[model samples]
Target: MSGDDGESTIQRIQDIVAVFVLSITAVLTAWCGFEASKWGGEMSIAFSQASSARIQSTAAEGEAQSARQLDLSVYTLWIGAKADEDDRLADYVEARFTPWFTPAYEAWVADGMVENSPFAREEYVPPGTEEAVELSETADEKFAAALENNQRGDDYSLLTVMFALVLFLTAMSQRDVKTWVGRALLGMAVVLDIVGIAILLTFPIKI
Candidate 1:
């Protein structure tokens, strides 16, 4: 072929290659953007959940504290009832204390006569304490889950930034350098973009 024809053929081939590279880079960029957006939304939701869980935990802790105070009051009442010499006063205090104890303990008190009885000294777990503890534990679990989701979101964001860089490099390859160096840079960018996309796919998508 003539020199001019050969030049035309080479130019056409370069145009085709540039178009292919640009197209793939555009698609990858869009995909990375979408994934990053999804991750950001999920991260926000996770953080919100964590905040709500903390609030619930705080409320439960307050309830637990109140129950402990009530238990202490009951103990003091029982002690006063035991020290009283008048039977009627002792009976009145015992009746007031009955509502504070659990049903099982109330039954024990009724059968054993708690004043000066062996069962009177037995530890009493106030109502609501167990439920409060369970709420606190649930809050901890939710917080941990939120942290994990946030980390995943960060990872996806980093990959999305990397994909943006790939798009920049590929676009520059078309205009800045006309030699083998340009092709080499484009090749490297394509490889990096593919790797980033693979990693993004491996992460579980929320919503």
Candidate 2:
């Protein structure tokens, strides 16, 4: 072929390659976007369940604290030894608190908070085993806050990941695309992806 014809052929080939890349990117972007949408639905359900569990956990912990207080008061009244009333109160408190303790500890265990199954402290002893129960409201409050934060964080992390995936799909769609409107959209998509990446990197996972 002539020199000019060869150059024309090369230019045509380049244009074809650009169009192919754009088309492939558009298709991949659409696929990833669908996956992200599916993930978003699952994340929503998981969040709702975690929220319900949190509310229930709070209520149960409150009941356990109350039981512990009663056990303490009864122990003090008996003094230096076990009395029938003290034993009865202790048993009652144990009954009321066991369910709460078991579930709360189990949750911690499931989240890898505790190393031992059926975990308990070696020195752990409830009220009526010795003296009046010394209530540390701060400890319980901190624990509740931790649990809440952990759950909230997990939910948010999952959501943010899905969002990031969606943005990635958008970015793929925009890359190497052409058209005045397409260019504008591509710019917006790049900005969104950057913001999404920033969010994912800046925030710590709750757990």
Candidate 3:
């Protein structure tokens, strides 16, 4: 073919490629939005399920604590003087007090003298253990949520990146300006990643 005819064929191919790239990018962006919405719903369900399971578990454990008791002698034995009174008191309280009351009383604090009642005394007990357990439970819930969301988010991210790559392959893909839009889309992807990270950080409460 003549030189002019060959140049015309190349230009036609470039135009076709540009159109294909634009179409692909638009489809990917729309798909990402759709997937993100779907992921939000899945995460909500996971949160609810996990929360319910944990509350049920806590109730069951509390019930188990309520069904046992120590005879007076056993109670005395458990509460008997020991070098480390705290251990003795914990055992004493666990043996005699009702499940609901025991943990609370065990955590109480009296005077500086440190009189811990096995059954019902005052002492300072840190709530961090309970909080940690609760936070761990919450974290599990959030992690499950993130798993669902991130999976979908990852798919969206992959498509977005793939579309960007397609744009790069086009001769008239608007190198400088469309590049800005691509960056914006990338920034949105980063936002999704940050959200997943936040869920992980807040899930295990700092106690």
Give the Cα error of residue 58 in candidate 1, in Å: 2.1
lDDT of each: 0.69, 0.49, 0.52
Number of residue pairs clashing in candidate 1, backbone atoms closer than 3 angstroms, sequence gap of 3 or more or interchain: 0
Off by over 4 Å in 3: 69-148, 161-207
TM-score of structure candidate 3: 0.44
Quote the lDDT for 18 in model 3.
Answer: 57
Report the Cα lDDT for candidate 2.
0.49
Q: Over the stretch 1-207, how does candidate 2's per-residue lDDT look in tens digits? A: 999999778656644544554454455444444544544455555555555555555565566567556545543443323445477655554445444344544465466856442224333343223222222333345455555545544545454555545445455544565544444554455455556556555544322
Could you give me the TM-score of model 1 versus the true structure?
Answer: 0.75
Model 3: ten consecutive residues of lowest lDDT:
198-207
The reply for model 1, stretches above 4 Å from the true place, is 1-14, 85-87, 98-100, 103-123
Clashing pairs in 1: none
Candidate 3 C-alpha lDDT tens digits along 1-207: 999999778657655645654665566556555665666567667777677767665665454344323323444555463444778575655566445445544454333325444344422123233544665577587667767665765655565555555445442333455544544544443444445334433322111
Itemize residue pairs with steric clashes in candidate 3: 93-118, 108-122, 108-123, 109-122, 109-123
The TM-score-based order of candidates, best leading, equals 1, 3, 2
Alpha-carbon error at 14 in model 2, in Å? 2.1
Would you give me the overall lDDT of model 1?
0.69
Ranked by TM-score, the better of candidates 2 and 3 is 3
How far residue 206's Cα lies from its native spot in candidate 1, in Å, is 3.0
Which is better, 1 or 2, measured by lDDT?
1
